[model samples]
Target: MAETGTAPSVLYEERSQRLLDQVALKETDRTPFVFATRFWAAKYAGITFEEQMYDAEKSAAALEKVLVLLEPDGYVPSLYIFGPTLSALDYRLMQWPGHGTDRNATFQYLDREYMPAKDYDEYLFDPTGYCFRKYLPRVAGAFEGLAGMPDFPSLSEWRFVGAMRAFGRPELRESLRRLLEIGERAEEAAQKSVAFVKRMAALGFPSAGGGFCKAPYDHVSDFLRGSKGCMLDLFRNKDKLLEAIDKVGELLLRGVVEETRAGGTPYVFIPLHWGLDGFMSPQHFQTFYWPGLRKVMLRLIEHDLIPVVLWEGDCTSRLELIGDIPRGKAVYWFEKTDLVRAKSVLGDTVCLRGNVPTSMLIAASPDEVDEYCKMLITKVGKGGGFILDGAASIPDEARTENVLAMAKSVRKYAS
Candidate 1:
């Protein structure tokens, strides 16, 4: 390890300067550093995945520990604010009642016994106080817990899934009300989460952590809401589906953008919920994903916030589809994606971030991680668009040697 210490003022200044230069779409003295870390945070801190999700204090501690240790060229990662996290422990709870925080980590559709006939104004989504009125109390409650240790249920409480909750209406409206209530709570949770992030941003190291961004298929796939249902709705009620997506983006991004600008953080996060390869093909990506993404990015840009998308799963198949995005608009947190080709294609447009194997991090020695990262820095960092980062969270169980290797390799090379 590079002596777990705080990055010196010189290093911090140089990183910020270089990153700002990149943001301007210009060359810089050094390539910016980005951390695609998630579970790795808790692990590096000697904690468990369940604890990171459930305990805000532990999550913050881990984040700070990593920041102090690595002191990368840039501090940027998404704030994971889901209702309940999907830990292995939480997933098993699904078999019981309200919802599990472990086991399946998937959303199993609850058969709602009843529902409102599209008329309950206060309970329903109201344009004015809709966000605060419905969710503020829950936010207040969570804030208290987090004031101690709050958590949002991104999972099905009964299941161990991670996603938004707009799809799959149940047979009975009554039972559905609980889900709806959870949705309301989610909205409230998202709003408060943004505020909490803003507070964190102000309190600690300079960073770019923002609100939530879950997709339709994400909910369907993880929650077991049925992809067929969502795809069918795309054809049956395109406007509604579109509206739902827009609502989610607005709820999650808008507040964070405002807070980010006010907080003076240079970057913004767009955490994609669906997988890169399976959710929908490139053609379908254009039809559904692109338009919403364009609007979300555009809106945030209007507020002078930089959007760095966390593209998950194997998106190698969709590289060409993604390359169409305008250059300098965003940086991708690419997960398990093919790099050589991504650099060749997308390099001309957006800033490409990562693709290190998480499995290798868990199994390999420091030498392996070092060799791989060194090659990546040399190869991808060629034209000035690459950002050093893990393709996904360096798995919690990753060998400590692997983490050290990746870090040393990144700082070792002088661009």
Candidate 2:
């Protein structure tokens, strides 16, 4: 262990600086190992996934237990969804562990076209009004009553008196009541997350990131248009879709910079979806996806924030296109992308974070795990711009011995 009596504060500063140094493509003592998992920690700590999602304290404790066990160079708080907050808003995007699945199972998202094709103008011109009046009502049960309310912009001047009458609707009143409850749950969830991050810092661990956002195309695809709808829109409604994507990208950049600054961490985590090689053609990626994502990354870099982008799926084809950002100002965490090829292309451009196979951690023996880590260290971790992590995240079923072997391999090989 690197920790000793009254030395946690010292360790925290050292670990934090080491990670920052690696992000700058500078030399470090060894490649940093960051523990990036969600439900796996709950299973490791003998806690049900349901308990971890609903109780912030339990979720933090479960993750804390794993940190003590593995002692990674950097750690992220449990990225588990807050069940009570979702419940309060009657959120309909996904089914959580206990609410919709077995207590031990992870949550699942339901993908459907929540926005119609004809509504692009409404969203592009007045997104806030459209969401409060149409989008939210269509998705969340608590916001269904909002459909009856007048557009907020129309509520100005003497027209406000007439607009106020919309609240008299029985459903709208109920929506207001639920919104109040949702506000409380949201505050509680925020406090719990901040507290957990502080506690981890005190235990000699630095966070992998302080804020998280999605690629703009993902923001549109995952929440508004379903994959099928968004895919078809590439041909059917390309112009409108592109305009909406640009507007959303700008909005996201503003929120990410503000929140990341307030969170007091320089790294902003972005998990990209829908922009992978399998999801779109290379031409489509150049036109629709890469531009918006690149804009956000550049803006984040300008703000002096490092964008820790996780390419969730195999984006091997888009590697060169994605490497156009400024050098040593970002981290690209790959799921299944080839790290050796990535290193050759991006070694001087940015820091590379991962490529470890999750299946091996779940099914392989300790010796096999050690050998794979050794290969990754010598190949990708050479020349000092790599951080060790699992493919995407550490799965809940990963073997304890295999996980331990991976953590230990860093010292044996990188040292």
Candidate 3:
């Protein structure tokens, strides 16, 4: 890889050294820090979600704002930009079939499907103008409710919001063309994507996305198809469901892994499920949701990539089933997960992060943030395997001071 020269590289190396310490299971200059955010940053910039999404300057400025405020030991930008920036020309083609709540694909989730019509599977491979009618309104309007709401995620997006804000209609169109075309056109797109990303690595962020894995159920519901279809396939033609994931899993993971490798990311994100807790029981998660992801995670770490699984929805109740994850090859980002049990089952093998209440950032005092963060560090930050993040992305409802204080205190006290 050609080195991105000067200060950015210098800062990257500096941060890398600290993260490297954590990865090695040794004490770093300080505890390693990591947080995924956009809402928090947008609030600081005084810009709407629209401004942040289409304007790069606003995105970066907002990022700088977060850096200035929280100054955490680690960071990961939100995924709001990639689809909009790299695929803008085909934004109409690339479907984001997310409901307000669905972020993971299926194995185990709630008793709902964002796209109940997924059983048709007609939309999976077809690219028709008709599908655009239903998809576009939701895609553009996902944040429409937030148009008047303060600190919308779209407004603060650097590539999506920032770029659109700065560029003329023609320039925006050309950039999108450069970004959307696959292979050579895709090559150009990836390069432009890399430029912004390299800037981040150069600006001192530790890179890792090769390990990006979320529950496929969310993917099922949002992108290719939805849970309603997948679940039906699972029950009616179990073999077909298995075979389909076997093929799709490789393709989805290969791109995420390759992108992370391309960007030189070390730690990648994985959210696991088949739906334990309120959604489904532990047995179901292991059989349907996790087996496929388990294969994916195994392959990821086999290549020396570290997997950070965001175990959403009360995964604390189901660790015994999932505990077999390759130890020391990954860390757990526990959301609504039980940390004590996680530490018992996962502490020795994998690193652990999170479990702080999302509501804490919105309503808790700084002392409360500090106390909760301090508690997590005390419980999980031992032996150098933990990094601090939230059970979920710190939301717009979270108080800025509380969020900043959470990061500050976690870094200050985490082992």
Q: Pick the candidate with the highest TM-score.
A: 2
Full-model lDDT for every candidate:
0.57, 0.86, 0.59
The local lDDT score (0 to 100) that residue 259 gets in candidate 3 is 62
* Ranking of all predicted structures according to lDDT, beginning with the best and ending with the worst: 2, 3, 1
Q: Candidate 2 on 200-291: residue-level lDDT in tens?
A: 88888778767777788888888988888899999999999899899999888767888889988888899988999888999999999999
Q: How many clashing pairs in candidate 2?
A: 0
Q: Candidate order by TM-score, highest to lowest?
A: 2, 3, 1
lDDT for residue 262 in candidate 1, whole number 0-100: 62
Clashes of each: 39, 0, 45
Measured by TM-score, how close is model 3 to the native structure? Answer: 0.72
* Residue-wise C-alpha lDDT for candidate 1, range 1-415, written one tens digit per residue: 3423544555555666666566555666655666545566766787655555555566667776776566566555443434243221123212321244352132233322111213123322543343323332232232111111112333445444322222232322332444455566566545655555454444334454443344433432233223555565556656655555565556556466666666556577666755468877676677677666767776766766677777887777877766655567677778777777787888777777776788888887788787888777777777677777777756656777677677677667754
Across 175-223, the per-residue lDDT of candidate 3 in tens digits comes to 3344334335444445544565566665666543434666655455445
Stretches of model 2 off by over 4 angstroms after superposition: 2-6, 79-81
